[model samples]
Target: MKILLLSFILLGLYGFCLGAGGGGVSSSTSSGGGSMKETEDTKRLREGRPLILTCEQNATNLETKWTKDGNELVAGDHIQLFPNTTLYISTAQKEDKGEYSCKTGSMTEPKIFHVVELTLQKHLPKSTTVLENDKLSLSCQVQGDPELTVQWLKDGEPVEDTDNSTRLEMSDNEYDVPNAVLSIKPIQKSDSGNYVCLISLYSINVNTTTVVRVKDIYAALWPFLGIVAEVVILCLIIFIYEKRRIKANFDDSDSDPAQDVKNNVDGKKENDIRQRKH
Candidate 1:
C-alpha cells in the first residue's frame, strides 16, 4: 500500500511540473509574437539617427542573441548590446540595413525583430527658373520599397494636369526604382511658385520643396541691351582719347618752328669748325 501511495505522489508532481513549464513557454511566446506584428508596422528609419531594438519576451533568465541575415552580431563601437536584450546603434547608415532577428535559448527559428530599410530620396534644386513659352521638367527620384506613392503640390495645393500641357509622368525602368517627373510644356509666368514632392510609404511620409521662377520672354532682352550699351560707351571713349592725342602733337610741332630754324644754323657752324680743325 505504501509503494502505490509513493507512485501516486511522483505522478502528481510530474504533472504539476509539466503544467508550469508549458505555461512559462506559452507566456514568452505570446509576448514575442505580439512584438512581431508591431515591428512589421514600424516606420522607416532615417539616416544618422540612433536605431534601437529590444527583445520582447517576458521570461526570466532568458538567453537572447541578435543576428543579421543569420550572422551573429558582436558588440562594437557603433553597435552595443544591453543586458535587457536591447541593441543600440549610434548612427544608422545604408550598409547597416538588413533583416535583424532575435533568438532565445535553443529556438529552432529566430524571430524577425526588425527589417532595416532606408529611403533614399534624390535632391532637387532649391530654386529653378523657366522661361515663358518654354518647356520645363522637374524630376523626383525615390529609391527603396516599390509601394511608394508620390504626389506633387504647388503652394500648398495639389498640382493639376491642365489640358495635357502640365502633367506628371512616372518612369518604368529596369531597376524598378520609383521616379516621378512634373512637366510643363510652353510654361507661363503664372506657373511660378513653390513646388513640393511628397513621398509616402506605410507609416512614413517625407517631402521636398523647390521654388520655381518664371521669366517673361522680353526679360531675356535686357542683357543684350546692356551689352550693346557697353560696347558703344567703349568706342566713344577710344575716339575721344585719340582726338586729344593728335591735337597735342600738332600744338607741340607749331609752337617750336622758330627754335627749329635756330637749331639748324648752330649745327652748320659746328660742322664747319670741325672741318677746319681736321
Candidate 2:
C-alpha cells in the first residue's frame, strides 16, 4: 500500500511540472507576437508620410487603432506607428493642424497627443519705431517644439543680395536663450515697410508680418519752428517801444518852441529898463 501511494504522489508532481512549462511557452509566444507587430509597424511608418497622432490613454494599442487630428484614420492614410509609439507627419499642411490621439483597443484608455503649433514672428528689438539715421535691429523669431528655419522678407520679396543701407543680422534662440537680436545698422527709410519672418519646419511653413515705419528726420522740425516764433515776438516788442518814444518827443517839441521865444523877448526888455533907471 505504501509503494502504491508513493507512485501516485510522483505522478502528480510530474503533471504539475508539465503544466508550468506549457504556461511559460504560452506567455513567451504572446510577448513575441506583440514585439514582431511593433517592428513591422515601425518599418511601415518609416516608408510612409508623416502623420500627427493623438491618444486617449497611455496603455492603448498603438499598433492597430490610430487617429489624426481627432478623426479616425483610414488604412490607406499612410501613417505608421513606431515601437516608441510616436506618430509621424509626412507632409504637414494647414488642414493638418489639430489634435491627435492613439489607442490600442476599445477597452484601453486613450492617450492624447500634444500638438505643437509653429509660429513665425517678426520682432524688433525694444522699440518698434526708430528715428531715421538711428541704429535699428529686427529678429525673426520662430516658436515651436521642433527647430524652425527662418527667412527674412522685405516688401513681400525675399531679402537676398540686399544693400547695407538696411543691414540685417541673424541670431537664434534655439537653446531657450532669450533675446535673439537681429542688428541693423543705420535703419533707412527704404527699409520701412511690412517686414516678414518666414519659418519652415518639417513640411510646415508659417509667416508673420510687422509694419516698420522709420520716423523721418523732419519729425523734429517743430522745435525749430518754436525757436523762430520766439525771435519774431522779441522783434515786435522792440519796434513797439521805439514808436512810443518817438511820439512822446514830438508832442513835447510842438508846445515848447513858441513859448520859449516869447519868454526870452519879455525878459530882455525888462532887464534893459531896469539897467537905464539905475
Q: Per-residue lDDT of 24-83 in model 1, one digit per residue for the tens?
A: 111111110001112343434558988877665444556679897679998999899876
lDDT of 2 by residue, 1-278 (tens): 34654554465555545433322111111110001121111121222245444333254334645576567865445454554455656765545544455666553676544344454332333225656777666555546544446676766676654564246666666544233444565777777765666655554555555566676655555444544554556556667877888999988777777789999999999999999999
Q: How many residue pairs clash in each candidate?
A: 0, 20
* Full-model lDDT, candidate 2: 0.52
Per-model TM against the reference: 0.48, 0.43
Which candidate ranks first by lDDT, i.e. highest? 1
Q: Name the runs in model 2 displaced over 4 angstroms.
A: 1-128, 139-142, 173-180, 241-278
**Candidate 1 segments exceeding 4 Å error:** 1-40, 45-118, 161-179, 218-221, 244-278
Q: After superposition, how far is residue 170 of candidate 1 from its true place, in Å?
A: 4.7
lDDT score, candidate 1, position 139: 68
